[model samples]
Target: METFNSSKDFLRGINKKVFIAVLSVAILMTTFSAMAIRKDVVLVCDGNEINITTFGGTVESLLNKQGIEIGEEDKVIPELHERVTDGDRIVIHRAFEIQLVDGNEETTIVTSRKTVEEALNSLYIELGQMDKVQPDLQSTLEPGDTIRITRILKETITENQEIPYQTTIKYNDDLDYGKTTRIQEGRSGVKEILLEVTYEDGLEVSREVIEEKIIQEATNEIVEKGTSRYLVTTRGDSRRYKDVIVMEASAYTAGYESTGKTPGDPYYGITRSGTKVRPGVVAVDPRVIPLGTKLYIESMDRTPSYGIASAEDTGGAIRGNKIDLFFESREDALRFGRRKVKVYILD
Candidate 1:
């Protein structure tokens, strides 16, 4: 009876140990199954779609598990602390950095807006009718892109301008050549000018003349030009002559050294005009001064004048505006040498 009772107790103890082991295994399997619960989610980031199966409970946990980072300017479709469920779609709009140059200010803007127009509107930056925007407003925003805004302004202004006067010249036969007389003084006029000025960012860019009104008419200036020729002599006598010429004067005697002739020749002392050569007789080019023409020769420098002379002789060396005066002696002729003189042809 004692052996049978001990055998029954031993079997009951074995069954109890088996039941406890099975119960512990079942509890561990249930905990593991609960931990292994997963959700099928679709994540859309910056227009890119990703399908993932995650065991995270919230959007934040899911992103943390996927090693994704969020910035202050970044946008998310749902709140980070919101619970996630199966077949849920999560959207993340990544903000991009853009360089903005508005007028004189340069700054950086991070925006999730797709177009430049939307980005500016989001910031409440207004644009004028004449303002210009580079890359256009409808252009898609890109990372690290530069957007420039040029502020255009136009203004009309009035200014006073000077109008130049005209000049009129008249010929006067009484006045001498190279002489001018002013008849009237010129006066500048005044005119008002209207200009449209264009400015870009407070700097002048262009200007256009819109209107002009004359405030005062300009007075024309009158001038008289001289045409007559006259000269005053040393004796304080004013004379009117047909023409005057500057000639190179040279003295010569009736000798072989001057005319290549001696006293023995028939035309030795006689001139081409059939007259004897004297102190007042001079040789000249007939094409310039006709033979027998009377002239008053005055010295141009400090030398004494040649006085009254007659063009009654001709020589091969005397041409153009050149004159050869007759001298009594070879020594006197050599002393005279050559000089420039003004010869006036008398009527």
Candidate 2:
């Protein structure tokens, strides 16, 4: 009887121990199930699903629990640290970087836009009427797309230019040199120049060739020669003619006609003192203002005066303060009129 009782007690204790062990396993399983499943939350980040086992109540906590760290350059559809619930969609985007260059200068721009045109419009690159760009205005933009801007402002410039007068020449004698006999004289020349220019921000940029032409032609001239002559009788006695000095010169038609313009004869209006004179020749009488005497005279009408004259010949037209002016043309000589003028004797 006592041996059977001991067996029964031992069997009973072993059954109780097995039951306790089973119950503890069941409790552990129930706790683990509670921890693995969260029913009151949702994930806000796009491009992500909410199947992860994060018992944490918030999106940020859930990410940390999953050992995922958000980057500064990265983007999330649902903001980090946002409370999440079931049936939520989360999106994650990696940031893109772009570098820009205007001419030789460089700059950096960060944008979320996917195309170049979008980025430019966002930055307000074109601020005014003068700003310009080179690409097709409606071209589609993509990443790494490069666009060039040409900010050239065009302007027109006009100027009056001086053109040098070229002498009218006819080849009197043919030779290889640059010299040509002048058939006519030169006057003046003029021309007009129009320039097209481009600038940037009021600074001169480039000059371009546009229209060029000659507007007006210069005038030509000719020099004329005279065929008149004359002679003179001195105030001093004829016998002492050699001793008398002429204070001034005058032209007498008789002597000039004989010696003047004659190839072999001495030059016209030659003074007795061997000095050469012309129609305008006004020399001091050697007797009055010795040979080589310096004198200043008002030759042209009330115009500027001249200096230093010597005893020259007498002429038919010249008398007292009177004088004749020589000119390249007969018309030019005829232009001068008879007038009273002063003859100054320079010491």
Candidate 3:
């Protein structure tokens, strides 16, 4: 019976050692499980980085354990209520004030977005086709930055305008010299014009003429200029003249019977203009036809025609339109008698 008791005590001692070993293994396994639940994560906030090993849980609880405070407008990547795993990243951006100007209205906004486009989207601001933005939508943003938006508008309008009439002049010989007569009166016309106008923020930016149409035809003014007279020459050629006259013409010779001066005299038969008397050289009254004036003479009785002549000398009987012609011989002078003739003053 004593040997039996001794064997039982030995068994009890071995069992106690085994129980302590088992408890140690269990404690080690519990510690390893707790270690397995921890994770190495990166925390990015305030333009800085913080690396740490932490227990796995929701992002909100982890941030709270690190003593990080989140505001209502603060942005957190992966969201605060989302679960975190090993090698997870936590990014936090602090909210900042921004000035937003849309057309004529301005307002203040709080946002944590990284770009201008994201911030505008968050604020529910929409853009139109013609709308313009400052600091472009894809640009990076900073605190207190100003964003301006402009609204563009276009309009087309049609207007009626007046077209002025023009004046034209024509020549007429019925009226006297230096006289002007109106043949037609002038009148204005009408036209339609289209214009395009652009405005920005209720202020005009530019205007352009787009189209034009004629609505009424204009009437031209006509004026008559009356001054000159024309004459027909015996040679069938038309010539311009200022006056005409009917004259008594006669013929004489450079002889003692024609002039009181003798033929031997130096001044006898010579004209006042120093020209020798001939068929085309004529004598005239200086008061009637001025000296050095050109003339065309024709016999009214159709006997002969004097194509062109010059008034270079004067005679006592040559007054008004009367003229005297010189012949080379006395017989020729006697043959030609005094008769009415047509005299034209040529230009």
lDDT of each: 0.90, 0.52, 0.86
TM accuracy, model 3: 0.59
Residue-level lDDT of model 2, residues 1-347, one tens digit each, is 99999999999999999999999999999999885665444443434555554444666666777677776766665677776665445555544556655444467666554455656676686634666654555665444555665466788887767777754444422232233444567776667778889877456888776776678767764423321211121222111011222233222331434335543565544555566554434433344445554334444345433333343543443444444333334454344434444454433
The TM-score between candidate 1 and the true structure equals 0.63
The TM-score values for the models, in the order shown, are 0.63, 0.33, 0.59
Error of 3 at 33 (Å): 2.6
Compared with the true structure, what per-residue lDDT tens digits does model 3 show for residues 1-347?
99999999999999999999999999999999998998999999888899978888899999999999998999999799998899988999999999999999999999999898999999899998888999999998899999999988889999989999999988877665567899999898999999899989889999899999999978989989876766567788877667778999988777888767777899887887888877787889888899898888877887877668888888877788688877788897788878888887877
Please list the residue runs of candidate 1 whose C-alpha ends up more than 4 Å from where it truly belongs after superposition. Answer: 1-50, 54-69, 75-99, 108-119, 135-146, 158-160, 176-181, 190-194, 210-216, 225-247, 254-256, 260-277, 286-301, 307-313, 339-347
Comparing 2 with 3 on lDDT, the higher-scoring candidate is 3
> Evaluated with lDDT, which candidate comes out highest?
1
Using TM-score as the measure, the top candidate is: 1
- Model 2 segments more than 4 A misplaced: 1-93, 127-145, 162-167, 173-179, 183-188, 199-347
Cα lDDT of model 1 by residue, 54-106, tens digit: 87689988998888898877777677889888888999878989999999999
Give the residue spans of candidate 3 off by over 4 A.
169-182, 185-187, 221-347
